[model samples]
Each structure stands twice: as structure tokens, then as C-alpha cells.
Target: MSVISDVSIPPARTAAVSRRFYITAWRWHFYAGLYVAPFMLMLAVTGLIMLWTATISGRDGEKIYSVAPQASLAPVSAQAEAAFGEVAGQIVQYIAPRTAEQASLFRVNQGDASYMVAVDPYTAKALGHWDRRNGLYDLADSIHGTLLIGDVGDRLIEIAAGFGIVLVITGLYLWWPRDNSGFSSVLVPQLSAKGRQLWKSLHLSIGFYVSLILVVFLLSGLTWAGVWGEKFTQAWSTFPAEKWDNVPLSDLTHASLNYNGVKEVPWALEQTQMPASGSQAGISGTPEGQPVTLDAIITLARALGFDQRFQLGFPASETGVWSISRDTMSNDSANPLHDRIVHIDQYTGRILADVGFADYGLAGKAMAAGIAFHEGDMGLWNLVLVTAFCLAIIFLSVSGFVMWFKRRPRGATRLVAPTVSEPGPLWKTGAIVMLGVSLLFPLSGAVLVAVLLLDLLVIRHIAPLKKTLS
Candidate 1:
């Protein structure tokens, strides 16, 4: 018992208010899980498939990326020429080998689809070629990013991820051991518990351990979302165009390089203005009057500290400048701090501007490191850790649905909110938190508005809905 207004407040009343708060949190968690569980499950499955595909095979197939080690290596130009002989199209990008045992990659544009031609670095042999859009990596990645339905799917996923974040927040609050329970009660699943309690214990312990990694996954994944990431976050964190002193800017951003729903460019630099070519204001690069070739650019890239693993992007148009980068998002290096992107004048081959990881804004810097961790691009240990975390997410999603199915009343399986009969508003305690989450993710905010309207306009008037929720 406690004093509220100089009068004694009954313990039962206090407990009722507390229980309502618990119900409120639980109800929100239930709804969020209902919506997000499917997306989370899909994302986890696709992500796991991608990780395994990348680990065991090349982007195309088993032999494309692998090559025999050789003491001698062919010229970079020769590798491109060899790949060009096979694809016989404009080479838009060049991917350097990550190891001596790996083949160099070239992107050849043929009509609407882009072809990936893997060439041997030593013998300049075109080992194999395949349409990148039809490849396994892009197939899994597009679904992971956009569900393969383009912008609409992207928005849906963004909403789910945003709401998923809220789910995590409310879940953490609900899972906090506020009772007279010890650490082991929450940290370890109770083996003695049976039925729903057993599943719940397992869910709570899994959620507790995997929460941080889940949040990372959500945030990093959102970095590619159409609205939340592109419109809002990118606006604030994009590298300033003014950095390219006195250089003419192109209408396109580095995002133009992203192909077939796969992000080949670094997240931090995606929205940065791409500089135009035909400029004299640049550092000494290709010698004057010397025709810039793939060989020259490759040598220059090596001299500039970009070793084996880097990308060379050809200009899309006549005025477009060449882009050379080695970013962790593209699996160039394990260390995010080593990320770098340099633009060069196509005609002059002059170094127009160079941006590194340190040059990104605070948000950009966080995303730079975050994307690496999210993609398991760091190393072998990182790959294993992320794989385990993704597996945990799959289990969490399945177990959540199991718990719901067990407790749902007959004929009310669409979505059932936990019963709360507190006298006042259930939203009172969590309004600010909900508002904050909505503001942080605008797509989620829009969906929240729709859901609120549904609750007020439809659910309140419907007998089954009102009965199930209230």
C-alpha cells in the first residue's frame, strides 16, 4: 500500500494499474509479432541462404570465383579484355580478386540485364559468365531487400522492420525480471516449465540474448529501405556535394551504380553526388593526352592503396566520371575504417575527389560499420556469429507464432490483443515511446496511423474485435 493523494492507495489497485501496463506492453508485442514474424522469418531464411551461398560458392556458381594460384599474373587490361571477349558488351564495372585463388570479375551490360564475367587474374582466361540478375546472390538479396516486388515490397518491409524495433523495445521491458525472480530465471530457460510457459521461457531467453544483434540487423537493413533510409536518413547523412571543389556535378548519385536491387556501392556514399568528367580541376592522374585504359586505372588504383579487393566502376554516360572504391559493403576489406571511394575525370583521368570512411557524417560512419556487421563481411568469426543470430531470429519468430496459436480463442485468430480492462487509457504509459518510434521511422509512423484509425473506427464498433481486444 502507498499514499497517492494523501489517501491510502490499496495494493490491489496499484497491482491492477501495473498489470494493465503489462497488458498494454504485451498487447503491442503480440500485434507487432503478428505482423513482423513472417517478414522476419523470410528475411532470416534468405539471409542464411545468402551466407551459405557466399561461403560455399561464387555469386554465379561453384567455379566462377575460384582460380588456381599462380606465380605470374596477367595485366588488369588483359583480364577485362578476356571477359569482354565472352560478354561482348560495355563493361560497367570491374571487381578485383579478394585472393590469388579468386578470379577477377567484370560486369558487362547486355540489353536490360547485366552479365558477370569472371576472368582468371593469372592467365586472363574468361572462366565463366552468367547474368548477374539471374544469379543466386541477387535472387536472395532482392527478396531480402525488397521482397522482389520492388518499391511496394520495400515499403512493407520498412514498416515491418520499424514496427519490429518497437516489438523489441516492448519485449525487453516485458522480459525485464521485475518480480522476485533471480537472474537465472530470465537468463536461463526453466526446464521444469511446460506447455506455453516452456515456449515463453525459451522465447524470452532467446529474445534477451539476440535483442542487440536483432536491433543491429533491423537498423542496418533499414539503411537500404526506400523511404526511411533513402528519403530521411540519407538526406541528413549523405556526403556533401560541395566536397568536390568547383567540379561540375552529375544529376545521378552513386546510387545509380546499384543494380538489380543489389547495393554495390557503400551505404555511406550512396547518395553522394557523382562528379562529372571533362574537368581540368583535378590532381595528377593519367598523363595528359594519354588515353585512359583499364590497365592505367588498375595501376593507379593499386598505387592509391587499393590492393587486391577493390571495384572500378565505368562511367555510365559520356560525362560520367569513373569510380574506384574499396568498401566493406562490397566485401573489399574486413575493416570498415579502410573504406574509401575516389572519383576520377573520365577524359582527363584526373583524381576529382576522394572520400573515405572518416569523411562520412556521424550517422554515415555508424552505418558504414553497421552494414559490415549486418552482412557478416568482417571475417570467418563474424560470419559464424551472424549466422547464429539469424538462426535465433528464425526460432524466435516460429516460437512467437506457436505461443499465439496455443492461446488464441476459437474464431479470433486473425490477431488477438491481450485482454486489458484498466479503467483509464491503455496508451497512457507508452504514448511517448510509440511516438518516438514512429517519428524515427516515418513509414512505420504512417502504418501506425492507419492501425490507430482501424482501432478507433473499425475495431471499436465491431463486436468480435472489441470483445477480443478489450
Candidate 2:
């Protein structure tokens, strides 16, 4: 019952206009496809790998628990001792806790790959050993993150994100319904045009509906990948201190907003001997101070009720701090966990600057939130939405290619359009200049320019002698 729904057009004119708009969209899709397909394929493949990681991890339907159901999790100190003793006489260097449950595991690098030794916190009983890269989960994650090529692969992912944004914009332009005749063609699949028109509608409609999701997914992903990744991290570092203003705790507005060199302070500034100083050459050992074992730090942290799965960083200087950053994955607003930085005195083993989780700025909180969003950890609803979006992308890419293939030339007859009469010299020159600017943002634009060159110089000129070329 829509106003335009009943409108009709002359059959001949309708056919002519519909074909024109369809070709324009097809050509735009063609140019963009040739430029971005390689990157898209890589992203698609890597995305598949990442999705498979979640599927494989959950395949068994068994709950992965760090703590034993029967036995209580022992004190952090005792758990560390048991784990160390179990792995003793094995040339061990450092042992760290992954969870509060003594049954939790720690990573050990023996040779080529890391090993996980699961231990009971109460008695330090060795549960089992697991290879770091034995399963598809590890392989999928590695490929998704680094493409198995490390930093170089990461750069490619970032570039893909940038171009993906362009592809989205251009696709919107090409999909824009020009007139009433093409409205049905743009919105709904054609059941009567064999399977070809049906696919065209499927691809166009899906692209239109999922446009926002695709853009957000790509941008958020870009925020994690390249030089933008550094920016995103720095931006999130300010989140902690921002929330303190409204909280009931002590005032934090006067605290330094800058985090530069904040973690560099010595644990015992005005006290006795410092921990060992870090070497200039590499990550050196602590100076000639009493060594703080993982057990001791874990004991202190647990006594303070720091949640499990937290990461512990050793002091940098001999007088350095032993920083224990509490895990934020499980924190709710009411019982928030502060990313802690405990300046433990190396000599007296006393706690110095015990900056709790509330010490971070607004940037830090935002960063944590951003990471949670990317990992599909925001909530079950978010995970479901992201999964749906990813599947939509797979469909869009495949359907787009299929539509292109179906419209391709056959035998000695190509569906060739006449040359678009060149615009005035100034207009053509100005348009190219504007396109050059677009190229700066999306490398795909440059690829489009190259394809135009091939089309104008080769395809168009050769179209007249199609039989010879064929």
C-alpha cells in the first residue's frame, strides 16, 4: 500500500532504465572487486579461522574450570609453592599463576613451544601437561592474528580495513535505487529471472541491511591492528580516573591525568637497598636485592582479595615496583577491580605505592571496554550479533562474485556499453583530481583508476573486434 508501490512504467523504458542502472552497479562492483578481492579473501579466510577457534573451543561442551570442585582453592602463596616444587629440578626460571584455583595452570617455555602444567593449588599435584599448539584452536588464533607471518600480516589486515570502508561507500552508491522501475529490483529478489536475478537481489539487499554492522566491525577491528592500535590503547588508558569523580571513594580529580613514567618509580624511594637494576642491553635481572618470588607476590595479592587470572609484572629497577594488574574481564561496576600497581620494596618486602584499580583514567576504562567488544565478551547478546554479522559478510562476498560471473561475456558476444561521451576537459581533469584524493584514504581507489585505464585502453578498444580477441 506504499504510495509508489502501484506506480507503473512503460515496459520498454522500464527495461532500458533498469538495465542501465544494473550495469552501472555491476561495473562499480567489478572495479571495486578487482581492487579489493585479494584483501577480502584473506580477511574472509582469517575470519573463518577465528570463528572456528570459538567453535572448536566449545565443541566438547565441558566447562573449563581452574579450581577443583571438591577442594577449596588454597592461599595464593601455597599454590605458587606447590606448582614450583612440582616443576622443580626441571631448570625452571619463573612460575606465574593464571587463576586462584591451585588447579590453574602456568605457561613454561621448554623449547619450540610453550607448555602448560596444570597443578592443584591445595597440594600442587600435577594434573596434566598440554602443548601450546597441538589443537586447531591455537592454529586458528595464530593465523587469524598474524596470518602466520607476524607483523607483516598485521599490516595487511589494517590496510584491508581501510579499503573495506571504501568498498562499503561505493557499494552504497551503486546500490542506490535510481527510479521507481528499479525499486523492486533493488529491494527484493526476483523469483522469475531464474537463479541469477535472485542472487543479485540477495547480495544487494544483504549489503544494504548489514552496512552499519560491516562498517563498525571493520573500524573496531582497525582500532586493534596498526598504528591505530597504538592510538586506541593510549585512548583507553584514561578511562580509570574518569569514573572516580562520581564514585563515593576518595577524590581523584586532583590526580595527575598523565600516565607517562608513572610505572617507572622505585618501590622503595626513600628506603633501603633497591631490587636489581634492569640491564641496558635487554630485560636485565633485578639489582642485588632480595628476590620476590611469584608465591610471595601472589600471597600478598590474594590477601588483598585481588581476583584470579590477573597478570603480575616484576619490578623494573632494583628499587623497582612489583606491579600486579588485576584482571578486568570479570569486573562489574558495583564490585569493580582496579588494575593494581603495587610497589613492593625489594629489601623489606613491604608494599609501597599500592595504587588500586580505581587509579586508571577514563582512557583505560574505554580501552578495556573496546577490547571486550572485539572479543565478543561484552555479553551473550553481543556475541550473537557479531556472529550474525560475520556470516552476513561471508554471504555478501560470495554472492557478489557469483553475480559478476553470471554477467560475464560469452562466446564472441560481450555485453558492451557504448563509450561514455567524455565530459569537458576541465570537468574530467577535476574529477580525476578528486578521485586522487579518494585514493589517499582507500588504496582501492587507485586500483579502480588502474582498472579504468585497462578498460578504456584495452577492453573498450578491443570490444569493436570482439571476434578477433575471442
Candidate 3:
């Protein structure tokens, strides 16, 4: 027998090991894409619809138009009154217009329902009113978040997002150019190629281009999921309400500030407890003998340099404070660094707690900035970039499905997944890395374990299933 080198494996063994690793990765990638592609397509389409609707027409017809910017504008109180007159409800929130020519939005509560009323600032005329949560934009957002099935859908989407990460990894591995293949093979699609080659080129190139953005979108969107997001990441990353000096705490959280069940509160503060309004626990900003009206709070907000677009959340109860917030979450300002939330006593109009972006923890600050970018709120460029990213996602999903269908045996009823081989040392290393990832994302981890069990106990044992899958 030929003497084997003590320091190195035989070339044949090395090639076999590499091939096994590739097959294993491809198998996992195929399964993940089989389930995740549809959801990814849904999210991308809905996200695109929401982005355009929010950017161009505004949510729920909140956008108002005027003939031109007037030299003088009506008082916010008059605008609030105009909105209430149109909606017939207790005014709960006021949104200042970003520009004089734009319309102001007032949120009104009528019985159990909440409505958004648009009033032209220049004319103080009620432009329109609609149910805040029942609008087209909100519908699209709900679909994106929960697939219109609530918590179950949220969990499913979270699993899909987790698999999405796996899909990207495996895709990158398969797309890795070898030998003399260079930038053109990796970056450019071979449109001139026929059949499977054409599909593979388009799928790989587009998937590679959008991989980073897909990760960002999935991570940010995961921040809102019921499990990994709400119970794990958000629970720890939330702004600490205890940072308030000697302030009376409320039983409720900053989640209470979410008007009409919409996520209006900043991401970092959403779970933080709200400071109560009693005990004279704040600095006085109330004018002498002047009630804290919408006008007064608007004036105070302006005085504090919340000049452009800012939101005022009316006191929820007798002890609740009027919440004045100016943050990138609401697209109030372009800079996340300037995010601020001020609570004025409903009874005393005193500034209770003033939390700024600088006060947030490292994670909190990152989330605040991440949310702004995720929403495409930075500028037109941001919108265009996200739009392209969304389109790429849809194209990738569709291309993946097309490639799968074309590769399957004609008229086959079973799923034609890649064949799996026994794990080599390299395969085991990949498994270890995935285990770490699963630990970080609990829901994802659970699903991964389930898949492993199914493969070992069910898929591998059943004759038809094994034949179909492999």
C-alpha cells in the first residue's frame, strides 16, 4: 500500500468530505426555502405596498393638501376643534404638521373606537376622518406582522425568518465561485443562458445582492415578534424606567401610549413603565391660571424646541401625564440622536420625566436608529433603497420556486429535496454554529430541533418519504 502522509488527508478523502458538506448544506437550504419562500414573498410585497402608501399618500388618508402655504395659520386648538367636529370624539392626541402647507392630524377616541382626523393647518378645516387601525396601510402592516392570523401567524413568520437566515447561508455557500470564475459569475446574471442555468444565475446573483438587506429586515421585524422579540430581546433592551429620579411609577407601561393599538411609542420605551402624574414629582411648566389645553401643550412643545413634527398623547387617566414625544419612530425628525419624550402632569402640567436618546442603553440606542432605517424614514434615498431591496426579495423567492419546480421530476407528487449524507467533521462544525444561532433565537432553535427530529425519526425511515425527499 502507498504510504499516506501523516500530516494531511488523502486528496480523495478531502474531496469526498467537501462534497458531503456541500450536499448537507444544500439539503437544509432546500427545505428552508421550500417553507420560507412564500412568507418572504408575502412580507416583501406587503412591505413595498406599505412603504409606498405611507410615503406618497400617507396612512389612512392623513395627508392633506392646500392650494399654497399661507402667511398665517390657525391655532392648534381650532384645528383640534375642527377635527373633533368632524369625528365627534374626545381629542386624545395631536400631531403637528412637519411643514406649514401640510395637514395636521388629531386622534380622537369615540366610545371604543379611535379615529384619525386630518385638518388643514392653514384653513383649520377638517379635511377627512377614518378609523386609524382599519385603513389600507394598517391592513398591509398587519399582514406583514401577523399574516392576519394574529399570534399563530407571528410565530410562523418568526420561524420562517429564522430559516431565512439559513437560506442565505446555504445560498452563499452554493453560489461561491470556484476555479477561474470571477466577479462576473458572482455579480452578473447570465441572461443568455438557457433552462436551469438561467434560473440559477438570476437566483444566485439577486439573492447575493439582497442578502445583507434581507438579514436586516428579518432582524428588525423579529424585534416585534411575540416570542424572541417581545420576551427576550425587547425585555432586556427596553429603556429603563427606573432611571427616572424619585418618580411615581404607573401600573401601565409605555405601551399605553400606543394609540389605537398602533405602535406609536418608541421601540426602546415600549415596554418601560410609565411614570405616574401625582405626588408633585416634576418641574412646573404650567402657566399661571391657564388650563393645560391642546394649544398650551403645543406651545410648550414648541418652546422646548420640538419645532416641527411632534406628537402629544393626551392623559389617559386622572393621574396620567400629557406625553409630548419627538422621535424618529414617528418620522418627526431625521436624527435619532435628537429623540426625546417629555411627560407633563395632567394636573400640574409639570415636566415629570424627560428621556432623550442619549439616556438609552447601548442596545436601546441601536434599536432606535435601526427602527428609523428599517422604516425607510431617513429620506427619499432610504425609500428608494428599501424599495429595491423589497423587490429583490420577491424576485428571489419567485426564482427559487421556479428553479425547484423545474428541477423536480415531471408530475411528481412528493417534495424533491436534496439527499443528505452522514455528517463529517466540517458538517458537525456547521451544526455547532447553528446551535449557537438557535440559542440566540429561541423560536428558531425550537423549530430547528423539530426539523432534526423529523429528519432522523420520520423522513429517513419512511420509504416513500425518503425516496421523495432524497
Candidate 4:
């Protein structure tokens, strides 16, 4: 038959098939909704709040430099002395200058600008703000991340992510076409101006297109759930680290030492060693004459092909350390835009650790790329795509519910229970086989087994309550 002629389904057969599909979809949808709807709603609301984040927060300030100045990447002890004077007593701490700097910046909290200064190591000139801005992005981040509810909010989101996976799986099963003829009906919407055509098209069409992305969104979200999920990813990704396997207790007591113009002092970083897990390593502070420059550092990092946006944290004190972390555009995780860390010594202006993209193992890179993709930072185009998908998900979920509620029958199915009858013993045997296969995903499998046991042993056998409930 021609593709167009294939559309001609008998009315009785079509209605019968539609009835079966609706019953199956409705049954699972009802159960899944009972289990997951609240969590899904929580995600939807949080997502919407995050969409407007760039407007609410303030930007953290950065150091501003002039072309006429050329300074050394030196330590900041001398600059601290000149800036604070002798009475400034006990260099307490220094702020790392936000520069490709060799200078250790310091803050005396002497007056109005208690917020640290990014001082020049050679000239002692004060630089700009060191903290990030608080803008709409921060507000959206907080809403998406913690709902302003702290730990409780995080836990709720984690649970929601877990529930989301189940919803997707059950939704697929419920949506699957039963026969070859049912394929078009399940996959596409009818164009004939019949009941709820556009609504049906919107729901089914969107869900079909976004199935893969939705799955990634749900799975990536689970990475934040807890230690269990963390370990699961670590294992799946095969992340390796042997250096932290052994630690000498004696190494903990001794503090590293540093020097002021006329005196020596103790510092924490000097005594500590980074674990061998491919962590970025760098010494703390710039040398007395060789100050690090922020612009220089950015150029260096870019040379390493980390042309993505980065945030530089200046050393807070003469004893403070400089740090740089690559920043991604958003929450998508599949893009490898931000998998880098850098540390530089503030005292001598030496590269402590510059972990490049190539330095990470296979799994680490995959994890990084996944994170980038999830954040919608793969590129500008993906950002638009993900935003569109998010809107589609929200719309589909609402429409699907509306369709179900509108067509639901008024009476209980109790009268048909006896006539419906149980599946044959062979069916039970097949269920056991299926349960065996499901056990690979331990958590989901255990839940399924428990559910099956409860249904068979309790729901089916408990006659009095079964009659009333059914």
C-alpha cells in the first residue's frame, strides 16, 4: 500500500487499539505521577528560575593594569611593608594580586576598603576588586542549585533527578507502539482537524525528538545526588589516583616557613603536599621583585589551548596562593570546556601545576566534556537548543497530563477484575527472567523486585482491601 493509503485504519480496530494504548499509558502514567510528579514540578520551577539568572547578581571585580607600567613577578613582602608600614604588624595575610603576577597581594583591613587589594609586587600600587559580581546569574544559580534552602534543597533536587530516570523509562514503555500499524499513531500526530490534534502533536512529537537529551539531563543530574552517585561515576569513568593512598602522620605537624624583610614566618601551604590525583600544583606567592601578572597568566593559559573563559583567584596574602579555574557557560556537562586548573607560586613566580586538557585521563576528559555539554556551554547554538528543549519538556509534561485527565473513565475497574484474570504461569516465569535481567542496575532492579513481590503476594492475595482499592 502507498504511504498515504496506510493511513486508512478500520474504525473499530483503531478505537480498540487506541483504548488499549490509553489504558496502558494511563495506568503507568498514574503510578509514575504518584511517584514522580512533585519532583518533576520542582525541577521545572527551578529551571525556570535559573533561566533568568544573569540579571540578579553582581560581578566580582578584577585588577586593572596600565600599558606604561612594567613590574617584576616578585614576592610581595616589601610592598606589604610599604603599603601597611611597621605598625601594620604581623603581615597577618596578603591578598594575591589578580594578575599574571609574581607579587603576593596583601590586605591590612586598615580602613574602608577591607576588601583586599591586588597590589603590585614592585611598585605597591593598589589594584581593583578581587571578588566576583553578584548578578541575576547568581540568583538563578542559587535557585537551581539550592533553592535558597541549602542542604535540604540539594537533597530534594537529587531525589528529583533519581525519580526522573524512572519516569523516562516507564514513559517509554507506556508510549511504545504495540503493532506495526500503531507506529505512526505513537510517533506522529494526526493532522486531520480532530480532537486535540495539535495538543497530541505537541506532546508526542516533542517527547520523541528530545528523548536522548532528556535522558542525558536526568543522568548527569544524578551526578550531584550524593557520595553514592559520585562513586558510581568515578567507577564508571575509572578515575585513578594512587598518591593519596598513603599519608604519613608526621607530615601534618610542621608548618612551612617564609620571610618578611627582616624576619622569617610560618605558612600552611609550604608544609602541605597535594594528593597525586592529577591536582593542579603551584607554589604560593610571587618573589620580592618578580610579580605575577593577571594578563600574562591569561595569555599563558590560552597558549595551552584553554581559550575558554577562566576566573583567576589572586593570592589573598603574602602567604596566599594564586589559583585559576576554567569556567563553563552553564549546567550542561557533555562539553569539555572547563577541565583545567592552574597554580603558581607567589614567592618566586614559578609554575606550580598547570593541568592541561591532554593531562587528564580518558574518563576524566569524558566527565569534563559531559559537564560542559550539560551546562549548555558546548557553544552558543547548543545553548539555544537546550533552552528550547527545556521549554518543550515542560510543555509536553503538562499537555500529557491534560490529555489523560480529560479522557479518564468515571468508574472503578472492580467489576472487570475477575473477568480480566491473571497472566498464565508462563507469564510469571517470564517475569522472573526479566527481573533477573533488571538486577544489573542494582537500585532500580531492587525496587522493581520489591514492587513485583508486593503486587503478587500482597495486592493479589489481600481480598478485602483489593476489592475496595481496585
Best by lDDT: 1
Judging by TM-score against the true structure, name the best candidate: 3
Candidate 3 wrong stretches, greater than 4 Å: 1-7, 421-426
Clash pairs for candidate 3: none
Candidates sorted by TM-score, descending order? Answer: 3, 1, 2, 4
How big is the positional error of residue 184 in model 3, measured in Å on the Cα after superposition?
3.4
**lDDT (CA) for every model shown?**
0.85, 0.49, 0.83, 0.48
lDDT of 3 by residue, 78-124 (tens): 99889989999788888888776678889888899888888988888
- Residue 440 lDDT, candidate 4, scale 0-100: 30
Model 2: C-alpha RMSD to truth? 10.5
278-372 per-residue lDDT for model 1 (tens digits): 86878988767888877888888988888877889998898988889988777677899999988898888899999998898998889889988
Q: In terms of TM-score, which candidate is stronger, 2 or 3?
A: 3
Collision pairs in model 1:
none
Which scores higher on lDDT, 2 or 4? 2
Number of backbone-clashing residue pairs for each candidate, in the order shown: 0, 28, 0, 84
lDDT score at residue 7, model 4, on the 0-100 scale: 70
Query: Which scores higher on TM-score, 3 or 4?
Result: 3
Instruction: Give the Cα error of residue 296 in candidate 4, in Å.
Output: 7.6
- Report the lDDT tens digits of candidate 4 across residue range 1-470: 65555578787766665555445444544554554565555565555445424212111222233222365544344555554652343333343333343333443443332333445556665444332223344455566656678767666566555545555654665566755557678677666645566676666666777778887876655554443243454445432222223311222111222211100111112223322212234333333364456545545555555432344445544445445545332221224543454555544555555554455556455545555555565657766776787777777667766765545456754422212232222334334434543543344455556767888889879897667544
